[model samples]
Target: MVLSSHARVITPVFSAVGGSGRSTVAGLLATGLAAMVPSVVLDLAPRLASPWPEWSSAPGAGLASIPPHMPLSRRQVHAAAGTNPAPAGAGWQVLTDHREWSAPPLAPVDAPAAWHQLAAVGGWQGVVADTAYPMAHDIVAARTAGRTGWTAAWCALPCSVPVVCTAATASGMQALQTALTAAAAEGLPVQRMVLALVSTGDGRLPAPVRAGETMLRPRVAAVVHVPYDPQIRAFGLRDATRLGARSLQASDLLVQAVLASAHASWGDPLPAAATPAALPPAHPSALPVPEKVSIP
Candidate 1:
């Protein structure tokens, strides 16, 4: 069978508490993966009051705007996924910021209908649901429901689906564990859980985090560590479109590792070239370094 035939969708539910870098990571992951196979990166972040027409720093021009209760269609979601430059008159591009909305409940029923719409896209090989810390509970619940729905829709192979959680700091990891524990207590499938350690320029995990993992690691599937790069900070800008090629390359490496472990295809070629200009010099103190941690 072709790789797409055996394609397994991966849903990455990111923690908002990590800062703007999480969204950048999610976007880079999704866009990069989509270049190889059909994928979607759902920005569950909140919309700002006044959106930037494009990525700019003009004064008084506020953040982007999002609808309060709009049921998104598949096409709308796809449009959001694709590159759309900001109109000169519009001011700021519609950036994906999930924190703009008031925190919603963790129940599946409370989730935006847009999720279901995106799930229906063609090929729909993977989805990355990037969320903020305040909305982590709700995002996890919604992702669980999505996985369950996919299993139900495609009964032939159930274990093929997976959910990855990305956290900015060790505290964010704790919040994820609490949310997952609650999900397990509620009878949700916890076996598919993967803890993605998102180091936000902090190369090492906090001592308290290491201690908590000693107790929680056994319950998770795998722990993947991704270091933060200074280039990721540019995502906070108003007109941020393209990400650093090195960052994209790093994400591709993660995708390959995930696919290999899942027995998915690793030979698939990397996506097209869309490298941005050279990044501004980062402070010497900001570069990231890799760390080793025991996976339970």
Candidate 2:
């Protein structure tokens, strides 16, 4: 299927210090986009492990066991589907690298090729990759060895590719800025970076912090703040995917605005209230809702 002019492929690389809610943001972004267009969410980080059963519980979520050395084909991916079904309008695939993180380097060539393959499947209009944090030096080395996967994935035309950098605090943002600066010095395009300020409290980003993000925005395609919501914890526990509907909505709006500002087509407006199918009703006694916890 041919991609729409609004097709946006993003690869969000989190910081090494994990637990900063990077995966949560990735999931929300993917779900949000799916509400609007055909999208694919790829989890590329090996360390942030997502259990298969939990993902399967969410409608439209599927797992694809992609070999590190092998390239995935649309048919191969479709064939990998098990009992879990894909969400409507989009699908989320968790690609695991069973090998040691350090053992299999991030093949630069495969990175971009994977995006192309995803676009080929289901005629994706957007692709969002949840990258691993503190990327191993070997991964960086592979990129240096002529792997432009990250660049190729986002640099596609008629698409607005933005890398959402999630930080716990301003200090974390500074450190990210430093690393991004170095990558720029090494010839990585810094202009494509967009900051997604994640608030750990009640999942709400304060106005002041939002303003602060704007102050430091770098060629910012758009700035998004993810409020600290308890439902994020439910990702593995229950079918709380709907809990993030609002967050996903906000994220989609930001992405749409970014694409429009870049002069790329924003495709058609999202369908009104397109919710993914709810997971089979679990025994209420089997899984009880947990008390809301304060955002850190």
Candidate 3:
């Protein structure tokens, strides 16, 4: 399989409806990518809804400190990112909030290219975003007066490889279908999207999930499952580095799937490189992109 250039930064998105384990998928993908190169996760979840600060090992300026509509330098980005404790965050970082309770949720991506602006910082090779949704709104929210300015209200840039997250349940599958339909309408390349099915329990895939995967198999680039790990449920991402072996394997596949996507997006030759954990082969599915959304 072709590898990444390891030269460019790509943000794989987990921008699905609430309760879809977006952060879970984003965190795993970031950690997996970090195993190869410097990587970070941009936590775009609103404060009350975010679980990041509780999971962080140290403290620093939380998301509320991000300079709105301003381009960030590598130092500025890292300063806001703070240090990630797991893996000693040797090669991984999270740009999220860590302030005390009662503070405000940081503003959304208010810049026209706010997400891209933050991602443009050069130190990392990949950025995984846990973005807010009802994307139709998020897409046009930039057009708002900023409550009164020419500036764009911050928002998530289009994902290089958008992974639609959902639980493996009948209801979850239904929401997944709705999200895909909505994403497609927003010009997102749903055909090239990846689906991360987070299992609700241990052992075999529930019949509903199996059926959902079968139905979506033909429309998306690939479908991967993230088995539920009690460790994470009990302790949050603070224990993510110690995920179960199968769960880790799923994360590896996730990383490969996105890498394969980046290679296709660039249509450039990518060579192989050693990785921390063995990864499964990249499916490398390149589907027809729609007319509206542009993924680069």
Candidate 4:
């Protein structure tokens, strides 16, 4: 389904580790979304290339160049093409910095203004920003998933979703918990978090996360299991048509989870009636904190 006329969704793929497959998850979600809604995938990571050909940067055009309040109609895009054909065929556009930059790239903190401008563009219904590791400093990626402060708290844009990717390992979960703890300390507004467990075999989630049992801060919404697929590792791209049967199935489930989180963040009624007792406490005071705790 398409987003509401005025709705602007910014789904950031977050992870504690470098190879948690956040980009792959972001690409698959973008591709699936493109099938239903006109979308754009903004690769904020300072990488040289992307696996999907759909992931491209417009020549000499970046987020900073878009003027405020300007209409971004197809005609306007064509006029700015400058010998390059308008980016068509894909349901989304991948916005990136020009290959050669005189200065350092912009950080995610410098994005709220640009995001406001980009959302005003015509026809685009949603945006998926494939971010780098939350702890990365030299990149222009969203550090805290689901936190508006990561982008300076947009004025017009209210609905933002974070899909947190973590591998099935002790360190992965610990890293995620640490990130959540930091977000809480900063008073970041994180309504919900989509925890995507990427691992081998069936990719079952840990008991603590599945039961919503945590001393963490951000609210966990869903636990998605994306089984490790060699095909995806080899290609490093997201295309359901090109993936194996198992990978395709997992990818579909991940897409559904991402959209569901987005809808919930947008204030839509949840599909399933959730009992408060079934979920972790949403209030900070309810969280368990050790008495005179010490970290060794």
Candidate 5:
């Protein structure tokens, strides 16, 4: 969607299918963006399924804890989400699902509204949301992508990208293709798809797979290759600072791609710095019209 540089961008990291390491990618993207700007990761998965710690359960935490649709300063966001040192003292924060066992689970339908409220809290350069795999009609990722100043990231194993190219004629890809087509038809624009390929080893795809990705390149806004590191799995998706050298480099590459995609997709560069401004009121006009923005 096309957004002015002043708008707050919210991106969702989702997988075409399960076991694609979507959450890991989302966390890395959030931490990476935090290095350049004030950013927050919002974990909207089911309570038990969220990978991040139950930070929302802390005193005065939870989505409800943040005032609804209010313009908050940068200090308020830092105080609410808490600060962590990553990318050398960059303030990255995370918010998770309501942790109270007695509390009713969040209704899927209310997700967009909840995210809107959180964005209104202000002081964020961007919000990276970790969405559950879309197996059902919820299509939360698509909903986020369709909004103005937002994008959707589809994470998958590195092998999966080649598989899409090599096995396009295979029946297995039918469901995935159909899903993607439907999402686009429903307003999930292609300019918003950050195709993140997570690698578990040396971060190299097979030659044939690489060619396949090249053939499929035009379908996505950008492709990021992430090296696999055990620490990511061991720590249950820790901060970027804890990543190893190769993994850290991969994270930086992925972040750079996302930022570039945001600039092109929104038709403006990433904001030079976070400013404390009120979020624009929600309306149909807020949805950006699709544009053919090229990704470098």
Candidate 6:
């Protein structure tokens, strides 16, 4: 479907490499966005690496089950994500890998179409996707090779914001710096990307991190520093509602930055009440036309 003001906002959390706290940032963003708008989390990561299955009650329901229609309504999405009766919450729904890790029906192969369909889902404002591993390198490689995996660059439409995650240590900072430079060189919308600086060790900011933040600020739309949370260290993100005050506040700040960035990138437009043009008459044997656009 054509994008409009009523479409959901898509936020894909990514990282240059592993050990970057990608999943943690994704959970925080989804839960934080849920505080205001009913949101959904799409765990586009591989089945073996996904962290959401233990938390989700539903089984045999995941990426493959998602409807590929042009647009999805809120109720339709919830039904897809839930059982006969949808989960009770104004919070969020999680869609992750539910099949065997090394089985057929690979998800990442068709990631972009899933993303586009979900973004067109009505009745929500956000979708925080935990992208696959080595997001920075893999996406560039896919695009460079003429394959159409879910590259954050192409998906950074007016309603979408791609976020890159990194740790706060010296080496971590350097890795992220290198990644941004390389991705920017490849035309991956680095200027509009969101940088998430996560701190796993508690204390005053490290010198390298401070310097890195200063150096990296201009290249991205917004930079968010997520402080270390004790609960996450003790347990996991299984209970986000129990996060410390500071961590919770950081999540909210991240949501605000995403919304603000989207607004700045795409000027506010009044929500349309109906389709702007008349649709062609439908026929039983008619085939659906492929949606395509030359972004450049």
How should the candidates be ordered by lDDT, best one leading?
Answer: 6, 3, 5, 4, 2, 1
Clash numbers, per candidate = 23, 9, 9, 0, 0, 0
Candidate 4 on 249-294: residue-level lDDT in tens?
6655665666676686655532322111222335444457879968
Let me know the TM-score candidate 4 reaches against the reference structure.
0.63
Q: Pick the candidate with the highest lDDT.
A: 6
> Which residue pairs clash within candidate 3?
63-97, 109-153, 109-154, 109-155, 110-152, 110-153, 110-154, 111-154, 145-148
If candidate 3 were superposed on the true structure by all CA atoms, what would the RMSD be? Answer: 13.2
* TM-scores vs. true structure, each candidate: 0.54, 0.62, 0.77, 0.63, 0.67, 0.77
Candidate 6 segments exceeding 4 Å error: 1-7, 57-60, 64-76, 82-89, 99-109, 143-149, 152-154, 269-296
What's the lDDT of the predicted structure labeled candidate 2?
0.49
Which stretches of model 2 miss by more than 4 angstroms? 1-17, 47-53, 58-75, 81-110, 135-160, 203-212, 236-241, 244-246, 261-296
lDDT of candidate 5 over 75-98, digit per residue (tens) = 455455644447686757776644
Regions more than 4 Å wrong, model 4: 1-6, 47-91, 97-109, 133-156, 200-218, 238-240, 269-296
Which candidate achieves the best TM-score against the true structure?
A: 6
Q: Write the per-residue lDDT of candidate 6 for residues 1-296, one digit (tens) a residue.
A: 12344645678787877888888888788767776666777767666777776555454366666545443444545565521111124356776656666677553544555454564453456677787767657756776788754565435444677888998888888888877876776677776678999997889889999998998898789999999988877766656667788887888888878877776676554233222232245633346777998898
Q: Taking the tens digit of each residue's C-alpha lDDT, what string does model 3 give over 211-281?
A: 87898888888888888888778877765567778777887899888767656665555432222232234
The residue-level lDDT of candidate 1 at 138 comes to: 50
Query: What overall lDDT goes with each candidate model?
Result: 0.45, 0.49, 0.65, 0.54, 0.55, 0.68
Worst 10 residues of 2 by lDDT: 270-279
Show the lowest summed lDDT stretch of 10 residues, model 6: 82-91
Error of 6 at 100 (Å): 6.7
Query: How high is the lDDT of residue 105 in model 2?
Result: 48
Candidate 1, superposed: residue stretches over 4 Å from native: 1-12, 16-21, 49-81, 84-114, 132-170, 213-215, 236-246, 257-296
Report residue 144 deviation for candidate 5 (angstroms): 19
Q: Who is ahead in lDDT, 1 or 5?
A: 5
